[model samples]
Target: MTKILVVEDESAIRSFIAVNLRRQGYDPVEAASGEEALAVMEQQQDIAVAILDVMLPGMDGFAVCRALRERFPAMGMVMLTAKGQEQDKVQGLQLGADDYVVKPFSPKELLARIESLLRRLERPTVELGSRQEASFTSGPFIMRPDQRKFYKDSREIELTPREFAIIKLFMENPKVALSRDDVLNSVWGKNYIGDLKTVDVNIRRIRQKIEDKPEDPKYIQSIWGYGYRWLGGD
Candidate 1:
């Protein structure tokens, strides 16, 4: 899945963008401040895009954007702010922001840019060498990369295309907590604006089947402030 980091201070606007993006089928991660955004990065290494609000309280968007560019120079970034200042836009672009938009911009337009950025991030698929190719497994959950099939113990698990994609990501990175944005990009395409609740809903369905007890959940664990992890047992 493609991962997105949203750095915005305003609760209303932050949620506004998040909900819309989620409904469109993209995983959306939220950071109320730049500090939190950094912490999120520490846990996840496969971020594809960042949506930054320029007038942040503590660290400001420019510093964060510049810092991110220094490390992940190829990562996509989109800056947002109430300020219409041309200098700020120029600075953000110089710092490696792919797109900059003033506040009050349409949610539709923002979603469009996000999709374009993700499209640019993807590289053509390559065939893995036979020796290096590996199947992802946890308990009865088994993923066959060659066949793209998921099995519970030896029984096949029924899944929609999206569900199959989500399972593939978790099985591939067991133990690592994946944020919602990461799930979305990995399972759904980037720029997919959809309901995030869909992730939670699907997880519930997944738990019901693989776990001995869904309420007392095992295998796929929720990481609270983070996202989900496939921890191998129930």
Candidate 2:
């Protein structure tokens, strides 16, 4: 069964979410703090998604999100932040969270958001038998869809699942300027409701990984008012 890790310092909220998750036919793993969340992940191998609160006892949600993202690139992460705090939502996304639910959200709203994220997670990057091989090469970069990894100049570059998705999308449509909305819909799912700034954050993160100088990127080029385009070399 698919398990979801709910990490919240407040027992009341944690229990509420767990109960709802159970009702939704999903297994819930509860944790009172970030440390416990990490421990739970280590012990439970079936955790597919994590719902983390922005405020925690020990490590904050942003820190925990970054840590979990590094360890589990494919795991879906959703942060719970105070309503109306746009900065918190942006921070969570910058730390590689897949989605965020503001505080005071209804159970129905939260479940809907989780369902959207899960749909994205379950979506295959590339359908089998549609391609000759699960790989692509452009310029100095080489990607293997089967491995979900990136390589530049034959050197491995670590990328989160979202990062990998964005890179793949750009690579497949090189020289085309993709709008932020296009990227959000394609990568985060059409039902995703969040700041479009997330595209900027992930793009910056990708440049830091694949570019020699992130300040002056050569591959993913910004189009000012539009969005970005992949500049693949010969």
Candidate 3:
């Protein structure tokens, strides 16, 4: 049986997911906080995935994720943060999170993202071993996808995971316009149900970090009615 762990504070949300995972034939374990999670995790082995909420009363989700990875490096981690907590989710990635699902998430969508993460984890890392190759360069920016880091003209730029993912997307497809929906589905996950403005906010944050003049960005060019694109300078 595939074991899964859910660390959420809310009783309803925790139970909701637990019941659903059980229905799907998964051996689900629930913990209300990071402390509780630790106590339970030791007893459970082969836990394939974990769904964790960002804010807990004590030992927030970020710390818990790191501890979990130390023990089960291969375990998939899905983070849940509030609607406006982009920074929190971004920080979570540094600790080795596989994916994130923002708050007000439907149980179904949560399950789907979980399944996708688990499936991706299921793939043998053999082909991925030692061969974790990635190379892409953008205007004034250097990308290391495997490491999820970005540098501007050799100066390291601290990009939030969301910012890094968005910038990476534009870099991979420079000069190609992408709509808000496209970005949401790709970076935020298709299960994202947040407002479109969330994209704009993240864009503004990224521009501030990458653009020489965020007030009038050149690389992350806006497309008016369409969206934005990375026009790497020549």
Q: Per-residue alpha-carbon lDDT of model 3 for 80-140, expressed as tens digits?
A: 9888786876676656676778888777888887776664454322246668647688666
Q: Which candidate model has the greater lDDT, 1 or 3?
A: 3
Which pairs in model 3 have colliding backbones? none
TM-score of candidate 2 versus the correct structure, residues matched by position: 0.91
Flag regions of model 2 displaced more than 4 Å.
123-133
lDDT of 3 at 46: 67
Candidate 2 steric clashes: 0
Deviation in Å, model 1, residue 111 alpha carbon: 0.5
Which has the greatest lDDT?
2
Question: Per-residue CA lDDT of candidate 2, range 1-234, in tens?
Answer: 779999999999999999999999999999999998898888886789999999998799999999998888889898999989989988888788877888898899889888877765664455567753467899999998766668999998877667878898998898999999999989888877676888898898788878889999889999999899999665
**Candidate 1 minimal-lDDT segment of 10 residues:** 117-126
Give the TM-score (vs. native) of candidate 1.
0.52
Report the Cα lDDT for residue 146, model 2: 68
Ranking by lDDT: 2, 3, 1
Give the alpha-carbon lDDT of every model.
0.73, 0.86, 0.77
